[model samples]
Every structure is written in structure tokens, then in C-alpha cells.
Target: MLTNQAIRNVANDLDRRWISDDYFDLIVWYETEVQIHGFQLCYDKPGRERALTWTRERGFLHTAVDSGESKPTANRTPIVVADGTFPAGQVRREFIARSGLLPAEIRELVLARIKDYEDRQSA
Candidate 1:
């Protein structure tokens, strides 16, 4: 769990980020009162990295990471680009399985968000 003070000092908002060796990064934002505002899950870091971003205003967006290596720019920064497909089943299974180390406060919220995204997609 991230401290509220740290989040405020770094972002001027309530945000938490979890980085793991499990090849996924989870970033979450909260509105005042600790209500979840949004979250972005970046997965498969070693191979074909992708991001699943969900926001209260924009809903869900799945994107592939453009590693900025194709053009050979001086500054190699990864950017999110539009992705044609989201392997929902694979991502869901992998996330759930690997998220065991997450803190209890955030684990369930992220899992629920994943489920919500899949539900919306199937609907």
C-alpha cells in the first residue's frame, strides 16, 4: 500500500503504483475520500507489452507499447499505441494468477476492474 502523503507529494493526487517481477505494473488513482478514479495495468513487459487502462470518464482502452526502437530515436521512450486486439482470456487468467502478492486493499479492486472490463466487452 502506498501512503497518501507520498502520493500527494509526487502527483498532487491520491495514486498508488505497484511494480513487480511478475511482468506487470499496476497504477491506480483515487478520487478524494479514497474512491477509485481509474487504473492502468501494464503487462507482458518482456514480450509484446500491453496496457489496459480504465478510467471513470473514458472507460477502457487497451494498447500496445511502442518501444520507440523502430525509428532509432535519440531518446528511447515507450509510448502506448493503439492495439487491434486484446487477448482478454489470457490476460485475465495471467493477472489473477500472478496478482497473489498484491496488497489486499488493491488486489480485489483490480480484479473487479478486470472482470468489469471483460463483462463490458462480452456485452
Candidate 2:
């Protein structure tokens, strides 16, 4: 299952930044050992719109973006660039909508995580 710890690890380790969110999922830009790019976590099951070959059916499907920018630069028009997935739980879309993870909801979690990471860096 997609534990909260996993998300925190991504935030702390990957330098995560929340850019956009919608009814389906949210997009995040993160840095890895090699490059910086964006990926998405679809709360619901994979859609038929794109040729998404999910890395996991029961977890969040993490797909690569063409560029580091989100599609449409506002909302997601998910285009399958690569196949990946996170072991996050398949929570309902409504739950995520009110989960304070999105920009419209609350930024406390994001800010706190960023602060924690920065503090660790300076320590």
C-alpha cells in the first residue's frame, strides 16, 4: 500500500514540488539522481484515454511527462511518456480532494516538508 512515509520520503529525498491538481490526480515536479521532471499519481484506476500501461493496477500509476512541464500547463491531459507506479493506496478521489494536498486545499503539508528538508540540509 502507499504509505504516508513513502510520500514523505519522496518529499524529503526528491525535493518535491506540487504544481497542479485536479479531480483525477495531482502532478509533482521532483529531482532525481540524474534529472528533474514531473510525474502524476492517479487516485482512481487507470483511464482508457491514454495508452497507459500501468506499473501497478492497485496503486498510483506514475507516468513520465514529455517535458518537465505539465500538460496544458494548467490541468492534466495525461500523455503516456513512460510506465511507472507508486505503491500508494487506491483512495477515493473525494478523499484526495479534501486531503489538503492540493494547492487549493492547503499548503501546510508541503511547506512543512520543505522546511524540514531545508533544515536538515543546513544542519
Candidate 3:
């Protein structure tokens, strides 16, 4: 599974510019592939949190906890997931793409990083 540490590591490795825009989707994919329960991504706005909650409530995967801050939040408090194997990269990429993000390469890269992190953790 994708632990907070692993997710953070992957997020840290990716270009922050790329990650800031779509980290939630990566988190959701990681959580779903790993079959984690009650996972949450802490954000600053209740609206963002609510958005994540909507996704989770729909049984998509994961949730977000908005910190209610005025300023836009950085990638604080990486998402956590119970330990488990994730889906293959192609499958993960497809999943994220379907979620509405563009440029398939971004999701592909994220999935690659996630797999790398998971491998390191297991090793």
C-alpha cells in the first residue's frame, strides 16, 4: 500500500509544479490500487476537502481534510494508505486519465514514481 511517507517521497521527487496541480488524483489512484480504507488528503479549503469527500463517498477512493487556510496550501501532509500492492503502471495511468487530468505522460510518470517508491519500501 501507499503509506504517507512513500507518497510524500514520490511527490517530493516529481516536479513540484506538476504535482501541485494534481497530487490528489495521484493519491486517489494510489489508495484505490492498494485498497486502503478511510485515507485522507489534508487540504486548506473545506471546499477541496468536500470535493475529496464527494469522491470518497462515491466509493471512488480516498478523502481530503481541508485545513481552512486563506492562502493556497503547498503539498503539506502527504496522503496515507494501508500497506498493499498497487496496480500496474498502465492501469494506474488509465485510471488517473479517466479522472479528467490531461497529458497522459503526467499520470504515467507519477505511477512510475509510485512504483519506484513502493519497491524501495518493500526492499
Candidate 4:
């Protein structure tokens, strides 16, 4: 089964919790082929990948958190990013892209970074 392994420390969008520097949910699954800055993840439930949908079909768009709607998956989950690394992910990349920021310019902006990115980037 897929699972969350860590969270990145930084900042988050004021309107959305999914894309943030404070807590970027990092997921790991051997079956997935996603490579969003070396971190593969799932924003929605299992089998809900938007990239698989037809071009004419509507893709998954995240909704703002609702009061008493449901609990987040990472509630009390024991995982975190170390001090030397930076956060990264598709959510952060998209957020930056949407905001007219280039991928190379933004280092500390991301929704999730791979758990081992710093080690890999350094090597």
C-alpha cells in the first residue's frame, strides 16, 4: 500500500493546504512512476490520477478544506524533512508556475521534496 513518509518545512499557500512549505506530504509506492522533483505522490484517493483521464474530461481540482468534512491523512503521522534539504513537488512546481515563477529560480518553494533529494543533489 502507498503511504506518507515525510513532510517538508517551509511555507504554504494561504488558500490551500496541499501546496505549502510548512507541510508537504511525501508519499512512496513502488508501483507509481510519478517523478515530480524525485517525489511521487497522490493528491486525491487511490485510483484518482488525473493524468489518466481523457483529454476532454475534467481533471481533479482540489477543493479548499471544509469544516468537519474529513480528517487529513497525515494527521499525527510521524514523518518529517531534515534541516539541510528543501521542499519540492508537482504541487509546488505548479504553484510556482501558476504564479509566473520559473522552476530554476524557486529553491525553497514546493509542496513536497523527495526524502533523499538533498543527499542526491549533493552527490
Q: Which predicted model would earn the best lDDT?
A: 1
Candidate 4 achieves a global lDDT of 0.29
TM-score of candidate 4 to 2 decimals: 0.19
Candidate 3 local lDDT, 15-57, one digit each (tens): 2221223233233333433332222222223233322211334
lDDT for each residue of candidate 2 in 46-100, tens digit (9 for 90 to 100)? 4322111111223223344343335556654535565443223233333344455
lDDT of 4 by residue, 8-117 (tens): 44454111112222222322221123322222232323322221111113422223222232457534532222232232344445444443432332223222233233
What's the lDDT for residue 107 in model 3? Answer: 42
How big is the positional error of residue 15 in model 1, measured in Å on the Cα after superposition? Answer: 3.1
lDDT of each: 0.75, 0.37, 0.36, 0.29
TM-scores, all models, native as reference: 0.76, 0.22, 0.28, 0.19
Candidate 3 has an lDDT of 0.36
Worst 10 contiguous positions by lDDT, candidate 3: 14-23
Instruction: Candidate 1: give the clashing pairs.
Output: none
Q: Give model 1's clash tally.
A: 0
Q: After superposition, how far is residue 120 of candidate 4 from its true place, in Å?
A: 37
Please provide, for model 1 over 45-109, each residue's C-alpha lDDT reduced to its tens digit, 9 standing for 90 to 100: 89989999888899889999888886645668889999966777787788778767666767787
Clashing pairs in 2: 2-87, 2-88
RMSD of each: 3.9, 15.4, 13.5, 16.6
Candidate 4, clashing residue pairs?
A: 10-21, 11-21, 12-20, 88-112, 88-113
The best candidate in terms of TM-score: 1
